[model samples]
Target: MLDALIQQSVCLTQHYTGSPVCNPSRAALLTGRYSHRTGSLDTLEWWGLERLALREEWLLPLGGLAVPGDLDHEAAKEDKEREARSDVHEPSRPSRFVSFAPLRDFVFQPAALDHYAATALFLACVRRLRPDFAPTADDARHIARICRLLEGMPLGIELAAPWAGKLPLGEIADELAAGLGLLATTLRDVPPRHRSMRAAFDRSWALLSVPERDILRQLSVFRGGFTREAAEAVAGATMADLSNLTDRSRLRVEPSGRYAVHELIRQYCGERLGAEHEAEAGETAEQVHDRHAAHYAGFLRVLEPQINWRASINSEVGPETGNLDAAWRWVIEQGRYELVQAMVMGLYHIAVAEGRYQTTLRLFDAAVQRLRAQRGRGEGGAGDAPTDLLLALLLFCQGHMCIDLGLLRRAEACTEESLAVLDGIAPGRLREEQTLYTKGLVALLRSWQGEFAEALRLRGELLSWLRTTEVSVWPHVPQVGTLFVQANECASLGFLTWHLGQYDVAQGWLRESLAIREQLGEERWRAYGLRTLAGVLRTIGELEDAERLTRKGLALSEAHQDRIGIGWSHSALAATLMSAGRPGEAQSHFVESLAVAQDSGHHALLILSLNGLGALALRRGNLDEAGQLYEESRASFERLGIAGTLRYAEAVIGLGEVALARGDWSRARARFREALAARACRAWEKMDAVAGMAQVFAGEGDTSQAAELLALVAHHPFTAHATRERVEALLAELEAELPAEVFAVATARGRARELDEAVECLAA
Candidate 1:
């Protein structure tokens, strides 16, 4: 019966009951002969009963039999030889071999379950563990989080699901966040290694060689994924070790060719790195961290020129943001001021473009504090221009960040301190350039404070000096010569002139700045110039051109992932849409700008977005919503101590329009008067206020006064096309109401009034 079964390719093997050991029985089953005849022995001695004779293979046909039995090392070697012989003779039936181990178990496969599948698996396990439990929406979310934290490992999910009976899902998630020990089961029916996440991880951990373990420990220092080069440099991982570890599923290779360890596994390795014995070379965790920091510092140094001069819009710093931030904190902790100084400017530009104002402010503030403490200790060398220069630059950069955050008072103090630090430095080309840069930041601060005239004067003087003076190239870097400063000054002049309602002059200055920026390949500055010029064009009623330029800027900003630039571009585009009478589209962009502003803590942009939303609401005839949004904008500007800004005036004018719609004549006049009195209210915005005042006068039956204000606004050269059209419509209405001769006289008198006279009439 056994021979017929073997001949039919259904061979079975088992330990013989009479034998004291299983090896002899296993050898007989493999060779279909007596153990002694096959050179297999039952004696427990060196090389006994472990191997079958290499020449014997009579149990079953190699290609057609399913032989189910354990094959030790020597027995497996003999089987392979016999199988090869059989393959050569048969010429058609090829033998195959497949091996399985706990390390390559199905539960540990590389492919993770998707979200829905993971959730269903978790819930199913939970139901099996506690049949009466029902999951809530919050429970589902927490389960999803737990699955993500565990990398969707099946045994991990099964081990964690039992805890749902003892703790809330959120608490279970919190416990998992604290450590991986929460993923353990007390169920005795399960296998020992399968019952706990740690045991399973230990099975894999024990398989790694000493060098592989050391490399993994070092790799724990990385926060996000790392490139092969970074892994080799920081962790001392050779290609063979990385490949071996990856094959064992110890590290995962991302689609982008970066490598990452599971977060739970990373935590485990990090703990071992912190507490384990020193490696063969006596390298400590601190030493590994130092290497990590040094590598990234050098990395940033290599990319610094590109970040500063060429690649501000789309720099290589994005992928390494996590690593760079970690490296920055480490250097700051170690008081490695020189390394910090080397990477500060590049990091500053990155923070500005990405709208990480608050985070970068804290980092730079810490750096400044550390430097000040070092100075107090007298640790700095004598005539330390580099140290002082770093301090000055940090202060100037911090001031710019503060301006973005609407902390104008702090910005002013920072600028003052930066200038004072520059004064202490010995007069040289470096000091001269730094001083000029700091003054430009101060001018920007003044403009934000609604002191446009002062900003304009400072920028004009800077531009003249930069253009006329012969700025020799620095010994180290010659790329950032006087031309860069001249371009910055010209951009500043354009911004100030725009705020002052000189649209044509603003356009000319912005175009010149853009030409220089293009020549220098400053894509970021070019995008900014395009957006500003678009605003000018929009105000002049060139809607098609304005939209085109605005979209181009938007595309550039989106491509660079520049959050601030994107928000500003959206706001600019929305304003153009509002002028073009597309309220629905305008509202959507305004909402997008508001969201970005809120997320980035950009206070100025937030206020601007609110004012824009208010305009859209007023256009849609939602008077109450418009009033509320305008009031919020006005209050925010007041709280920020920038109530004199043109934005605040615009908000006030919006409220006046709301009142005019409601026929609240007294409230309308009051709002218009407040707007006209704002110091930053330039010619076009003042004309808007005058138009509101004229409507109020007409509502109160003062026809002659209303006609005069409307005519005055229509005749102003700086009046925007949109405002002028509205004023003309109001004047025509007044002409229809009044007698012909009386209307003609009122119009002539109003057209003769100067801008200042018109503003005074509105204020009265």
Candidate 2:
């Protein structure tokens, strides 16, 4: 019939299935709005047919219904309960008058419903039909689950709404998972087509040709959706087959031009694929599986660079993550170590960078489990250089993700294991370049763990190796030269040295790295180098230059949509602004940074921004606000198991500053000591904590100890900044209180003492 219409010069337009069942779909078609709006949400009841039930053949344009919001909030709970019961109490209300709630009523939008408007519509209609329903919090959640299980089909909602009265929402949802057999209706007046969800799908399925059926079955392997290119590769589906399936309402074309099938239809196709095909029992299945896996693997590998470096990485690659997972599972089953390694490496770091930490960890765990299993089976045993290399690289990637998640102990374990594996390989047998890469990662881990001297030593060694390593090809980033690796090493070395108070040397190394990245056209890494150098400049009191570099880095990251880059650059720029005494502007950038951090779930970036906000709050004398911010940051760091890091120390010390302001001498001293004891405490943070402790001593009438501690930090650059005015005033007051000779002696001894010696004195 569709072919006949096309032959007769008919134009077929795209539309939603309206509702999953016939009666509701017809009512929507007749009313030009949603089933709920027309008071025809049930499959068996003929909606709008009290006026007309003609079967004339004229052109019918079925406009799609807008989806409803996911009602999971407290207000939404009240509104949904009220709305659900409205139909039972107010049957005389207009079709649209049953207290329908808008999206704003929900506590928050569920992430899954962000795209599926049709699903939201079905959920609204289902909620409306159950006017007498009351539910617990868990039952309220089942609304989303039911919509998802039914794939937002109207017929499924119609069938499930009745069950809401006798059984719990969860039970109805669970029954739907058992298949369409549970969704049958007993209404005698309804058309046979609308009697069951399966009946509607069966009519369409029977109209398909053998090729169409095969393509549809194969396409069911895709989880979310698939592009034309993916379809052709994985399912051996041609454009014509897709068009036919689409025309027959067996498949859907999303606004992004990707194709999708309803979950119910996909399940049906899956069953057919399992039952009807001989390939499932033989070698042909392997070929099809290989093609499907290879298609997604290649897709990820091609986009790996963008995924790793861009802020828009999630939007670009998120749609295909389901397909990627499917590919990984297939390769794992086949014990294909090489493919598994490629798949994990391609997405793991990018996933972490985008804040999908749990997902990336799962990927790492699954791949590692497979690798260990292969080793136990002797497939990955000794002298298999390829498998060994794959395992080592996989472990390295896993460690990198662990670092981002603040799993410092887990990170070290994985990275050390990677190093151990690399060391076991004969020196000349393994690739020299990959070995250097692992060593570089270990250096980074050391830096994050606050072993500054060791970090600098390892990073310097990496720089030396990077200078001599030759590369004919730079994977993924072809335009980046061998100096790219050296440039990155130099940046790390500069940051490490800067933290250790070697400013001049840090400047030289940072400048050289930035110059190299710019010359090589390494845009993303160039942004990183700029932000790193900007931080160094900020530390050295070169505020103008620091602001300029940070601004450039921000612009570059904004252009590339690199969230990590944007976040880091924003932090650098904010700190620079704060140092320049522009607290208002700095607060704005910190707010932006916090928003981005929360959105991306980037723990490290979030901590930095929160600390910055706390610092700003302290300066403004909003002691309570500063305390709250610092406490939140400390809690997050502790939760992520990264409380020993320098960032967490800053938060701890900020809390001490608040305590000092509130005149809580004992509490201030304790908090300052806690900050000082953190292994990750860097020089500036240590100085800040010491200053806060000195203030506590002054408050306690221990002027001698207070003057000595104040003298230790008096010559530091922090004392010159506006942020330290309070500490500086306290020092002046203490200086006057002490005898001239005592003041001079204390200052002289402090100036002569090394940082470690001062720490020891404070501890005493």
Off by over 4 Å in 2: 1-31, 34-142, 145-151, 160-196, 279-286, 303-316, 427-431, 471-481, 580-588, 595-601, 619-622, 640-642, 717-746
Query: What is residue 115's positional error in candidate 2, in angstroms?
Result: 16
Tens-digit lDDT track of model 1 for 338-369: 88977787678777876767767877888889
Model 2, position 230: C-alpha lDDT score: 86
- lDDT of each residue in 171-274, candidate 2, tens digit only: 77566654556666677754576667677667767776778877877876776678888899978788988887665556667656888766566667766666
Worst 10 residues of 1 by lDDT: 86-95
Q: After superposition, how far is residue 594 of candidate 2 from its true place, in Å?
A: 3.5
Task: Name the lDDT value of residue 366 in candidate 1.
Answer: 83
State the C-alpha lDDT per candidate.
0.70, 0.65
Residue pairs of candidate 1 with colliding backbone atoms: none
Candidate 1: residue 538 Cα off by (Å): 1.3
How many steric clashes between backbone atoms does each model show? Answer: 0, 9
The local lDDT score (0 to 100) that residue 720 gets in candidate 2 is 28
